[model samples]
Target: MIANVLTIAGTDPSGGAGIQADIKTMSALGAYSCSVVTAVVAQNTCGVRSFQALSPDFVAAQIDAVLEDVRIDAVKIGMIANAGIAGAVADRLTHHRARNIVLDPVMVAKSGHALLDPEAVSAVRERLVPLASVITPNLPEAAVLLDRPDDWSVPAMRAALPALMALGSDHVLLKGGHLEGEDSTDLLAGPEGTQAFRAPRITTTSDHGTGCTLSSAIAALLPHHPMPEAVARAKAYLHAALAQSDALDVGQGHGPVHHFHALWASDG
Candidate 1:
């Protein structure tokens, strides 16, 4: 049967990231996508200007409605915004005993705007991370989640994975993309061990939705695919999406990776 994935996230009116990106990713990968909007942000390729989070009760309602009818194969979470939303998510998932939860710890946008509230960090750590099937955090996000200082290095980042695992997630994907380096390396640190993927850094400004895209890809591959395997596959999938989107026209500042790149290439 085809995978049915749910993405609980914010909405980007520009449709470059958030729920738009998740749905695009799932569709590109042949999975049906269900979305629950946690917040609505007034954003463009330049940056986010303002945002409003959904009521925590409404957030819980969306999840309950989806789960009551659809047998969700996996769930991808992004841009939860604040503790209220985080608590709402945690409560619903815990009650349902949902499986294959992929948590993308999104802190800041590619435009350097803060995407998560500071107070909500603890909520995500305590309520969400423990239940996540895999937690994917880019260097800065990982540092924030683990309280690693600003000067943390790759080795230091690598060492923190175990501590993160102790937080209760079965697998922790520490993304090295934010590190200062020629190549971006992402590590899948889990009980099985660490699996790393290093790719040549593509120097492009079109990279607004990477975290959302990666988490959604991971979700679409889960339960049927092992954590390590899913991490590897997701990286490759996102790489292609980025490469194919290299020249597409979108919003003026940092554009989005072309989730339908594969389809465009195949038709050519």
Candidate 2:
């Protein structure tokens, strides 16, 4: 059966991140993609110029529209934007008893624009974090969630895992991309303990939608694969996408990773 994946995220007109990236990632992985936009962002690789978040009721309606009609296999959530929207999403997901929930705690953009409201942090922790099967947070995001200084070292990331998992996720994938290293290592820690995935850092500027892409890929694969296998496969797919990122000439600033790298490569 084809997996039906739903993504609740903000919109990126640049098509590099948020709902655009999630849909692209899901489609590339052979899953049918659905989306609910929480905010409309006027942004590009350079930075976010402005954004308008939708009403919480509107966001909730969009989620219900999809869940009530389709048999959603998994859900990928990103960029809640505010506390009200975050609470609304969490409430709806709970109502549906959603499965295979993958939450990417998107707080800031690569261009240094804050995507999540500081006021909404508590809402995400209280409402959304507990609902996730897996929570993917980069070092900075993890720090914000835990109310600590940004620490990206391997040891720091490893030490922080159990505390992150304590937020109610079954697993925590602490991304180490921000750490200065020859290899970009991601640590996945959970009840089964921890495992690390290391890949030679793809030196490119086309990493606009990496977080959205990775979390969506995991959501897409979860219906058929276990947590560890899903994470492993998602990392493999991300590495391929990052390697081919230079091919996409989208923006003058950081461009987007190639979501269909596998298909394009196979076609050649």
Candidate 3:
């Protein structure tokens, strides 16, 4: 079956994160991608220079246009940067339901620029997150969402995982890449308790779109396979993408992880 995935998020002109990353990741994982762009970022590896958000009505229309035709099996949501867009997308999904909905609560850029308005946190937690099948939050985003400071330890990180689960997702993948550690461990806590994926620290500046890629991978994979199996496969794909990130010389500053890495080697 062709897994049709709908990605509702912002556009990254740099092609590292946001809507671009979601589209690339979904298609690479064998899913057809449909996008509803919430905002457009004038961004590159250095960081996001500027951004312009679409009106809530336009965002909804984009989603409607896609869902009206394509049979969206899964939904992967990235940077819904404001409360209005978040609500619009969440409310829209009430009717156009996908079997798998992965929410990557993208609040900050890789370069530390805040993407979502701080005020929109309530809107996300209350309106959007509860509606998701899975919610993926990195350390900083988790801390902010949970109202904890940045001084959280591994135990603290694990502690917040349950709270994220409580927010109503069937599963919660709390990415620990932002946590200081020798090996980065992302905690997947859900009804089955926890599953951890640990990878050696891949010290690279090209880590811009990893979250978007991972969530989209989950969304794409889950419709065809079980969640645990899907998450494991998605993590591996992202690791390989990060490992081969050097192949893409797309921009001047921090670049995107190479999605075509496997293709280049296999075709040669």
Tell me the tens digit of each residue's lDDT in model 2 across 1-268. 9999999999999999999999999999999999999999999987788899999999999999999999999999999999999999999999999999999999998888899989999999889999999999998999999999984689988888878988998899999999896899999988778999999988888888899999999999999999999999999999999998877778899899999987875544
Two-way lDDT contest, 2 vs 3, winner:
2
**Which digits, one per residue and each the tens of the lDDT, describe model 1 over residues 99-156?**
9999998778887888789999999999999999999988788878878775566788
| lDDT per residue (tens digit) for residues 193-259 in model 3 | 7999899888877777889999999999998887878889999999999998977677777789987
Instruction: State TM-scores per candidate.
Output: 0.97, 0.98, 0.96
Which model is ahead, 1 or 2, in terms of lDDT?
2
Decide which is better by TM-score, 2 or 3: 2
Model 2: per-residue Cα lDDT at residue 160:
89
Q: List candidate 1 stretches off by more than 4 Å.
A: 265-268
User: lDDT scores for all predictions?
Assistant: 0.89, 0.93, 0.86
Error of 2 at 190 (Å): 1.5
